[model samples]
Target: MTLPLSDSALIGTCLAATALGLIVMTSGGGGAAPTPDTAAQTETAASETAAAPEPSLPFGAVPAAPDAVDPEFGAQVRAYLLQNPEVIFEAVAEFERRTAQSQGDMDAALVQANADALFNDPRSWVGGNPDGDVTLVEFLDYKCGFCKRALPEVKALMEQDPNIRVIIKELPILGPESELAARFAISVLELAGPDAYDSVHVELMEYEGAITPDYLEDVASDLDLALADIVDLMESDAVSTVIEDNRALAQRLQISGTPTFVMGEQMIRGFVPVDNMLQAAAIARQ
Candidate 1:
């Protein structure tokens, strides 16, 4: 008949089995059988050896000797684990829960430490409700497919909830093209204004073609902004500073991918559905 084990008992049994295996493996096995005379001599030698004083150890430490493995106990542990495989799954699930909770706590601390840079940076464009109770920050690269996919979901989130403030951080990690796109966007924000930057931001998110000077010029022309001035300002110290600062912030927050969202204290590492976002927002509000 099988017997159930408590969580602590189960873990203890597994640990004991591991230690037993190590001890059994290290202890030499299958020695030749001793003759009657050899057994008598071995007993005499053991008596003399026991009578001798043990050498002194530093710090009055006692010698640690591994215990002999109980074959019956090892068999029982093996049988229990095999019969109740669900226990392993339960243990794994519990481990994952704890790990996720720990990571969430660390992310919350990180967010709190860098709240001003994340939520109130003057360089980044602020959309949705600026005075909203809840703030959502996104670190994105224009060339990332996930970022493109996330744009609509973000838009829908703002539309559905008018009180949600959104902050955009340009993190161009894809390549030079992504960097150029970000530079152009930052320049638009600095040179023109938020309205112009907002228009260009959407256009860039929606644009499927390659990001080139010609394409950027066309975008500027459409917005009735001077492309020459934008181009000149794109490579300036002001634009470089924004990108550098964003990269530093991302490194500090351990964000290595695009479409990473910080909704309140929670950090969503990748693209998630709108419902999940709303749920996170709701949780954040509480």
Candidate 2:
């Protein structure tokens, strides 16, 4: 006998049928009447089913199908998730925290592996204490506004703590002007030495005017250096190699912007105040 089912019973039956790999078909009215040949074929099939022998079952019983999910439990879980949406936020926050931590660890490893190139590259200028206990490396671009802002903070950091060694990596990623400025500075270092490069570095960082050949030549003239010689060396392969190496190093460290500082094992991206730099220096000392 067929019996009517409630909503819950219908849901349960659907779930059970799905788990049992059974299809539940419904019809609003009787289907088309069967033809004589169809009826005869159906009778023959039924007679063959009755004549067929049943296959042996394991332990004299048929295997059970997987149990269906409890409808009440599923409904309760859906309701709880909808009411407490903050649970999703909490999960997202946790995921971000773990991701940041993993990134930090990977960065530290990269720093350690490239320590010599980072701290002791003879081509790069080394400012502050030569025998400092801790080293702070900055990847800077002359055209970067934030790098200009970070200049005084870095100066203050070195002045306040004499034990910090600062290394500048000339990363001219901004455009033509930035490249011109970096090439000039490195060329100065190559020909006239670190002292002349220091003079040009400070002037470029503080100069408010646009970067051009005349501006660089004027700076060289002010510093009492051979403007013609520095300009000539700017496009030389030696100067180009220094910039190329710095770019490769930045790529390895995943540094895409200027004023990125590597204090010991910790990396500080973008511009930060002197206070934060000081704290990072202290942490590096440890």
The best candidate by TM-score is 1
Segments in model 1 whose C-alpha atoms lie over 4 Å from true places: 1-70
TM-score each candidate: 0.78, 0.71
Best by lDDT: 1
Give the range where candidate 2 is weakest over 10 consecutive residues by summed lDDT.
22-31
Tens-place lDDT digits, model 1, residues 33-117: 3558876887899799999998889897889884533434555555675576566557756766797899999999999999999
For residues 1-286, what per-residue lDDT tens digits would candidate 2 score against the true structure? 2359854456555544543331111111222234688768868997998899966688868667745333334444445555765555565567667877998899899999899999989998999998999999999999988899999999999999999998999999999999999999998888998788888888899887899988887788788988888878998999899999999999999898888999999899999999999998888887
The CA lDDT at 102 in model 2 is 95
Candidate 2 lDDT for residue 22: 19
| Candidate 1 clash figure, as a count | 0
**Residue pairs with backbone overlap in model 2:** none
